[model samples]
Target chain A: MAQNDSNTKDMILSLNSIEVLYDSVLLAIKGVSVEVPRGGMVALLGSNGAGKSTTLKAISGLLKAERGKVSRGEIKFDGKLIGDILPQDRVALGICHVIEGRRVFDHLTPDENLEAAAPISMSRAKIKSEKERMYEYFPRLAERKSAQSGYLSGGEQQMLAIGRALMTQPRLLMLDEPSLGLAPFLVAEIFGIIQRINKEQGLSVLLVEQNAVAALEIVSHGYLIENGRVVMHDTAGALKENSDIQEFYLGGGEGKNFHEIKHYSRRKRWLS
Target chain B: MDWIFLSELTVNGALTGLLYSLVAIGLVLIYKSSAVPNLAQGALTMTGAYVVLAFSHNLGWPLWVAIPLAAVIMFLLGMGIERVALRRLAGRPIVMILMMTMGIDIFLRGTTLAIWGGSSRSVNLGVSYDPFFLGDMLLSRIHIVGAAVAIALFVGFLLFFRTRLGIRLRAISDDYLASWSIGISVERGVGLSWGLASVVAVATGVIWGEVQGVDQSLSVLLLKGLTVAVLGGLDSIVGAIVAGIILGILESVGADFLDPFVGGGSRDLIVAAVLILTVMIRPHGLFGRHDIERV
Candidate 1:
């Protein structure tokens, strides 16, 4: 159950043998378990359809929107069973999700997007200062704060997406694919800000990404998933050097032909 | 034709158009937040007028008390409709949701008829039924009040869009899932939108009822509002207002000149033609947001 341990108090998010299904028929996640300590950044790395996004959705209670349900297992946020809470209520509890594809409101200006993200209970002064803090993290957003978000470039839109999440002043931030379709330089820049936010604000994060190298560089721990099940979990440094991850994910290891890499991935030790 | 007569007709048409805009705005608000066409909006309007009648005439309440009370009741009714009927139908196909709204419309109409009887009733808003002169053109006071109130409501909505709650509504309309993930209650937002829209519907009905007696025929006004919404873009408030005015003018001018040549009541025909043409040309409406899909 991963409960009653002395260190469990420090765990910001914990999923114990969680199983997610779509339409009550198709299983998307099968007996997955993971944990994120308070103030620690954890990355979930996987290929497409590996259920990384689904895991984030389940933790944030966003699965109900897509007709997906956690048919089995439980998810806890800050030691509370949050699997049954609504997505909006989850935000009041200081958990915010930056969904994939940077879904900013197209008709609104960047400044307005931040305002919408701010909780209704927050005073105007708090909202304004939080917005200013976000602008400091992404100065490019400051330059385009008044422009309609839909017209912003891809990098700018991604910045707005993260900045919007930051406006909630969350204790735990879950981001899905912040690096998708972004250039390497922009990806590094965004990750740097994420790292700075985590360090300075003592915020916990659960990041899902396909860019393992960039994600691993900032994350404290990393978990590898394939076909909705966790195949490996270790410190970021260990996973970066693991033979299987080196060959299959990092594109490392010497003399590994394409066929050998594919064979190795197919028969991973954890899969058995 | 005399220039004064032409100007009078134009002014009258514009005033009537503003009323249409009032009705269409309610539909646009519901569509924007909930993505439901809200076919029942017209019925809501009819019911609102009847509620006022029940209060003022049957219950012997003053206009001041009855109007505000009726608006409050209609607002709750709107929220109830969203919570009980539309909430269950969330995430359904758009067509199915729209059909449900039609069913609601039928239900409301039948209920109103059963409770209030089918006979027409006159509503007194306490305004003097005197004709005022604008230069040489005679104007009805009711039409003038209708125009003034419609414009006021339109301005109020524009100001609303600038507030924090308005931003939440706009955010939900832009992307439901994104808004939901960021702590906005999408359901509550949609429900509130319905509530606000119903308040507008009630106002529209009261004003409209003062001009034309309240009866089952008032529901036909929904067709006019729908025509305006379709021509202007179903999701655009600005488009609805502008299209309403334009249709109103077209009906006024066409009824006077063109109707004599092509039988009676060419206004409906003209509005229908314009709706079809607008759909064929600019389906997104004059100011409606066009979805840009990125691969």
Candidate 2:
């Protein structure tokens, strides 16, 4: 417990060598560790099947719902051990996970989606004001406030998903693939809002993204994972300049055909 | 064919449909939140009637006091059922939880039989037995009161769905993980839905008992409610009410005109036929959202 307090004072969330398993048979994440300092934006960058989403789910306590369990290591949130806490209670502790695929309640209208995500402990007045604040941040949401979320375009749904997370007034927001299936302009717009929110509200963020270029552009710190293991961690600028990241992730390598690419090879050079 | 007789039959059928709507709405509440078609609903209805009987007949309590007491007891029983039996099965396969509900239903029925005995009992609400006349058509005051109460409850249900709690319930129904990630306790939400459904069950039982006597067979009324629920779309509250009324009219009118032709008991046959047709044509049922995939 004394050791727990040492690292968490500066970090809003800390994952210490956590391992996640699905169905008690399939290991999805192996010995992963990551952290988000107070009010800092950290990006977890990896391609599909790289365990980026699994790490985020572990922190938000959503692993159980998917038959995925954190089998090893500790997750400390705000200087307290939180691996055993329920996902719903994690929200009360101010950790919100905007899950992958912009999972807005399709049946609910945009405004009602915000209402559903409002923290149970918040007063009605606070909820109302928070809703207004959301509309102010994404004025397009105000235009389609009453439309069913399922009918919204991908970009609008992404905005509503973020707005829903904001409704919880979380201290740490864990977003999984926010820019997936969005237009480039929409990605920039959404990432800009995320940056502004982190800057203005001082909210810590742990963003998991396959789109490393977009994510690295906004995040202060970045970690690159391959096959469930963190191969590299550095400041976003340093990561952008790293040879392996530039060669494989940023598509700047000298490979014209797929076979010559470093990532196409079975072995990862960074890990070796 | 006398038009007056037809009108009376239609009006009577509509009133009976309202009662079916009340029971179906209870089914909808549990089904919507938990995705379990609570098979124990029949036993719950039986238990509710028995609770009222114990308070009113056995304890010699007044009907007014007994009804509320029975409702309170059943509500807690519903919550206890969720917490003790259903909550443990959360995230389990739908079929497994459904089977558990069936087991619960059987257990509750056996308990009812052991405690209440197998005798039919009348519930006297102390209302006047006078028949009200609409022109030449005679209407029972009890039926009128039952219809009024059912409508009032339906209206109350509509208002509930518009409240914050209702929105949360809807959110859980739509996507359980999304609801949990948003900080809504899916387990507690499901438990509350069960409790509220039981309260509806109690109201239904008391009103139903006032018209038909309270008996073990009263549990069979759940089959009619199930029919309404299936025809209306299992998750749609409005669909339940509409389907209930339609079923009532069909049963009443079918019993009147087709019973003799079909050698009696055509009401059940008619309902089964309609249910089959609805399933074949619109599997989502009236007012149910069709799950269309947008590629």
Candidate 3:
């Protein structure tokens, strides 16, 4: 609430007083505010159950289905009141949410899954060109084009999910928990891909990650979310240098090991 | 049965089985995509038969024009069900959806009987071809053409699932949230699947009407089609076709051999029993995905 006084420009997406709850009992997210400008990456960092996922779902219109109503909030995407928009409409407007769990269509072949994510208006030639671009982005997916996504290894599925999102040609690609259940090498690899996507394609990203340190290292800005609220917001470099953030949020281990350094005592998690 | 008789019966059953598969395939598609068994699938088939009767008999349209027209009408009816009933229950429990379809079945049957006047009726398209004979066996041109059309459709669906649009439909069936986030219109996909199902149902109805004649009991006749879908595999399209043929032959032979021992109306009981056994043995139906992983 105090951070509202410091006005910021260059906002691509703005959430003013976003509050989401699953019934009255589960106050999954509370009065969370965030702003992401076009062509920049911002991380919403928190541990599990810290309402990071809830915030992403709210922005994605997934919360509406789960009875998680936005009791009070205004979500403006590209300066439009997009709070009431449907999930598919949001994608037509170029906001792709790369959810966690790599939930691609397991029964479908990898190529088919990629085609499903492609925009409906794309011509055959454009589809082929997009396919070539995806292959260039992830050579491993190209190798297994005919195989079912169910049989793909964990890392490959993660690559496929991101590749599928990119096929939509989205403006703001919101990634939820990109670093979960990955080896350090793969985590680094994914983060590197995100960096390239933002820099080379000029794609805006609102990345929510439990691996705070790694996420903060790649993004221009960071928000520390705990108990459904944004507790800290600053330049990624400033948050990286903050001692309390470093010890508690980022962990003392290598920048990718926030899962090991998590502490759960400070917030009234059930209440908030 | 002797070897010659057995071989002839097997061929007869197999041809009939293919027709059963055609009828069952649409039910599987609607069930897999919409997760509703659509008991009204039978009613849809009946409606298609009625449409044919209306066009060919009442209006004196050519059979060529009547058949496709009937199918198109049934397709629109399927879309109407999706808009009127299924759309309202999106994201609700699977049971609630099933109950809603049951209500649809009742409404459709009542409306049909009221309009068509609760009486048995027969329709014959004025194709003056003689029945072809093969070694003391009689086969009509309609049966051969019907069987061929069914097989072609089955192959077409196999190819369709490989296409981009089919992949999106399958994706929504697998995970709604994942598909939606990637810009797949779940509502539209489900509606399309229902429309496809109705097309198959209408095709089966036309063929069945041509073969056995149409009646007010035509909806009840779809019970056998449902049996094929359940026995072959609930969600598996190929399974439904296979099961349909298998059941058709089995029921045919059972009626020929075992009906006298069990008394009259034994075929229905046998089909129901076989369906129950298949479901109990493999709850997902044969060839369906056995494991569902949740995280």
Candidate 4:
């Protein structure tokens, strides 16, 4: 609700010169800074081990544990300095990190999984209303509420992870490789839900992805990271059209050539 | 052979089963949260009984003042164990932690020997109520009250698990990193779990003292607690309680009825057999989530 609706202008998260190192030798990310305004999706694109995941982890406070220390940097979320804050405290300050691999609480039922992210103190009606609204966005989750999260399909599990994060009512949601290991149809479905969450709920997102073409289509702004530094920062459209991006990521596909590939992306439109 | 005799035996077994459940349930709580088999649990229970004996008998405190104070002291002791022993070793392999707890058990047993001078000490609550006769049977009032308290504590624990804090504990058991990320204070929760387990141990010790008298050897009751926990399921509170009752009843009834034919003392053998069967049938124990390994 703090995000802009009509004009759609607000600064939700600001990373000022974050330098993340792993084990004092492996520089996962260095001297990177980016701003994600409210109510829009921004993609951090990179290859495997290119520090895309590391950047998201730095913001979420997960990277700090893996010797991925933020040696010199500051992370400000919703006007608060969060670099020294504990991960759980960061979660309390309205930043939800949907970790990669859809790592839900597998022992819990889907409803209990959502309930885990519920604030330590809340009235019953407020909890109910928020759950109802989340169900509206993800009706499939409602049907599977009684099922254990471990039993869900990959796409369903991804939906449950996102829905559980939404339960906390975060201002900025940072998702790491949400499209990993999903069928093409589920990936597109997830992206569609991400777009809706931003537009309707006025949520801001810093999306990290290995699937460059798919991620570029969903977000407004984009950054390319390689070995712990940002190499490309531009509008999503510009990144999509960059010749190097096409050669390395999109397999030399131009506007005309993109129509011929029959892969996971095509399956979303034709198969499902 | 008489019907009246059979009814008396059934009531006695049921009473004993409730106390066993109290001790075993404590083990289940610790194992579920920290994944360590507490070899020190029996020692802790024995320590609680000895603490009460010292306060009421050696130090001249009234029974009313001694028992609750002993339980509180033991609760603090349990928290100390968590902070000093278990906290540093969390996330280590299960075998090493088990060995550490075993070492704690040995240390506690030695301390008990050194302080109590390896001698038996009489523990009396000074309740002067007479045993009442029903038909051909006599039942002591102390046993009845102890059984009632144990059952009540078990019910209270079931309710605690339904509250928000209880759910948070279960979430930690489900996934540690995920629970921490969601704002559940893992260190605080672990400490509280240890404290609760200590309270249960004190209750178990008091009842055990009443039934079997008190001595340094009374620490062996920890073995019974471990057996119950293993049979019931290490991580399941309901399973631990149920298994405790079942094992207790089995041992009591076996000693009473079958001892005549099985050379007069095979109750422990029956318990050992049941434990083997439980482990073979369900390694995770009854009600425990089967740990599914994915590569």
Candidate 5:
């Protein structure tokens, strides 16, 4: 970790050529570098097992629980190198990760779930107001607030998961597949809200999604990862315009699905 | 048939059931947060009683001072067990944790026996042994006081789950990953559960110790408490109390009526039977929640 990295200044997050390993074997991240400008929304677009989620987990200190560790390079949040901070302590530093699969406490109501996510010292008055703000941000959650989160629809649960993250009042919100398993309209609604939050509150968001088309619409820039290495990095507009991205990710060509084998073969040729 | 004796037995058993509920509640707290059955719960109960006995008798501390001091010590010991013993085995299989707690139970049993010796020692908390009459039934004053304390602690625990810290504990039990990502200190919540469980176990030990005396046999409480815990649905607090009362009544009535027909003691035997039956019939326990499987 470079203690005085002059280049990381003005950036909210800078992943400095980091590598990750699951267990003692199986390297999962192969020296990937990415950056999120202050208050910027960035997307990590990749197919399954491309290490996008692992990168976000690395940033949030969630990898330790899964027997994964940052084996090399540094993760600097707010220009400070990530250290031996517990996952819960990352909340104090304003890093909130809404993990994949809309993981809310099913036994609790949305209200309690939000309250549960709040810092221990958060006052009732502040929590109530923050909850109200969350409700305003997602009216669907407010309508279903009385019911247990288990009964919530996939879209509503994702909204509640995001709302719970917001209750922490985090400066950086890392979302893992927020659009997964949702209708197109609901995806647009969620992505639109995320865009609004980014613009209004200036909350830096690092969104990891396989749904490149939807993610590209809301994020300012995007990184395309293939087999643990970043293969492409560009502005959303440029990525959308790229011929390879069009055939594979943006769906202007091919069957609107990532041709994984073809893409891997192309990466092989490109690496050579 | 001694109908009056049966009714009296029922009442006494009900009060004893409350004490068992108190002990079972301790087990539920640990299993609730960590999803691991704490086999050491009975050892904790026995250790708590001996600590109080040592303080009040050997150290010559006042009864009022001895119990609370013992409670505080047990609380720290419980948390220390989590931090020092359990935390080291984090992310291991549930079976490993299960074995770890069993090891702790054995360790606690040996430490208490080594320090206090195996002899049964009684601590006089000044409860009157004179049997009091109520509607043609006899009641011990100590049983009434024990029931009162158990009820108060149960009420306190009931109120606790509604608070912020309590909600966090419940949330952690529901989803460990989500809890950590949401900023909940899962480790602390688990530690607190152990601490609270230890505190309740101490209360059970003190109340029961007053009547039965603290002995190596008191460690059998783990079996009794485990039966109540399993019967109540290991995760449910209210279930523990309900199961405790039921077990108490059944034990008392069985001892009175069936023990004579059988060879000798059947009080503890009944609990073991119920534990086995509950597992075979309803593995989730009566009040325990089924896994909230996301469809």
Candidate 6:
């Protein structure tokens, strides 16, 4: 509610100082405010357990599954206050979340997994066209679509996950750690396809990644979340050039002893 | 030692096994979507039969009207059980959910006992009790009808799993959070599963209630269903059908041939034997976990 109606109207998703509590005890996310404009790509970049995934879960209303709740703040999705909406209804409202790890249905074939991800109310023809569209974007998936998804390569599984998310025809697609464990080439290819989808279909994306360098390359705006707060929110260029980000995240730091000192100093600097 | 009698036993046993498959299918559906072993399936089955009896006998309705009516009631009751009983225990350990199902079993038993009293009741679906000869083998029409119902359910499920909704339900069983992430309502999937489980319970109840008098012993049918579901693999529909047939033949053949030597009842013992043996050789059951978790 901090922003006026006009200010928030164009945004696909806006989180205003939201706080997340796990199991009524652990404070995972502390007053985090993030937004993705309609049809824009944004990245929330952080290391492990930095609340990046938690924020995504908060918006998607998936926190309920984990006994986590957004104890404070309002989440507005597509100009509606959606903080209390159920996760499935949020998907109906066009918020599809591709959670961390390549969590495809391993028992099913890649083709079946895509079909499963389509909205339950979708027509068979629409499912067919959307599947073809997914195959077009991730041709590697189409080649292996008939095979068991569990046997697929890590990169292909990642593509399948993204393809499955797109099957929902979501307006805002939130992906958590899509590039983890993939080769640099595969990550680039998948990220490039995601960028294309965002561009061509006006599908807004909120990508959470530990690979800040690659994420920054594709996304327009980047938020640096450390511990449980957003330390830096800026244009991708500004983030890529930030000294702290360069040293800590982009691997500019050197020496094991020096790395610990820099980590301590960086934490202090970010916190202050 | 008669060839015609032995042939009759074999074919009849397989058809009788279809009834076991009928009951097992409900267990498979619930376990597939929610990963919860519904211990109350037998209780629901007994209750379902009595509900039908009340409608058909007490209310003087026809079998056609009573059967579908009881199914709808059981379906809604199943969903209500999910919402009121199972939903609260969502993120709890599997053992806790398993225990909740047992509590549901006990609660339902008490309710049925209090309502219907201790005496057994007969539910005549008006299916001709007359035996017909197929060539040299004599078979009951009930088993044939059971086979027909089982086949219909099998085909229905086969066509269903191929659909998008069925895929979504299966995905929930695979991973709940992921299913919810993509907008698949894990609640609805689990709730629908409970409803289907109850509907199948009604089907089994009505069929069995017609064959054997509906009584307290009907709850023992859970053990038979459990044996088939476990031997077939808890989550596999095809496994349930195949295992049910195998178990059915073993029971019928054993009761006829083996029971004479061992005094009286050995059917329950045979089911327990299959369960122990299947668990020993294939821990996941015949068709469960089709893919060995790739290292």
Q: Quote model 2's TM-score.
A: 0.94
Off by over 4 Å in 3: A1-9, A21-27, A252-272, B58-60, B127-131, B264-266, B292-295
List lDDT for all candidates, in order: 0.88, 0.87, 0.79, 0.77, 0.88, 0.87
- Model 6, residue A243: displacement in angstroms? 2.0
Worst 10 residues of 2 chain B by lDDT: B286-295
| lDDT (10s digit) by residue, model 2, range B1-295 | 8999998889889889888888888899998776788888877887898899899999999988998999999889999999999887888888999999899888988999999888888888776788789999877788888778877877888888888999999888788888888899999999999999999888888878878878787788878888888888998888888898899899898889998787998888987888788889888788876653556
Choose 3 or 4, whichever is better by DockQ: 3
Model 3, position A83: C-alpha lDDT score? 88
Candidates' TM-scores? 0.95, 0.94, 0.89, 0.86, 0.94, 0.94
State the DockQ of every prediction.
0.71, 0.72, 0.56, 0.35, 0.73, 0.67
Model 4 C-alpha lDDT versus the unseen true structure: 0.77
Better of 1 and 5 by DockQ: 5
lDDT string, candidate 3, B1-295, tens digits:
4765665666677678777777778777886675567777777778788888889888999888988898888788888888878886777888898888778878888887888877767667553357756676655667676778778888888788767788788888877778888888888888888888888877888777777778767777567777888886667778877786788678777776877887777778778888888777877776665444534
lDDT tens string, model 6, A185-208? 998999889888888889899999
TM-score for candidate 6, residues paired by index: 0.94
Task: List candidate 5 stretches off by more than 4 Å.
Answer: A1-7, A252-272
DockQ of predicted candidate 5: 0.73
After superposition, candidate 1 runs with Cα above 4 Å error: A1-4, A254-272, B293-295
Worst 10 residues of 6 chain B by lDDT: B286-295
* lDDT for position A146 in model 6: 93
Judged by TM-score, which candidate is best? Answer: 1
- The regions of model 2 sitting more than 4 angstroms off are A1-8, A255-272
Tens digit per residue, CA lDDT, model 6, B1-102: 798888899889999998999889989989887878889999999989989988999999998999999999999999999999888788678899999999
DockQ of candidate model 1: 0.71
lDDT of 6 at A54: 96
Model 4 / residue B179 / CA error / Å: 0.7
RMSD of each: 2.4, 2.9, 4.3, 6.6, 2.8, 2.6
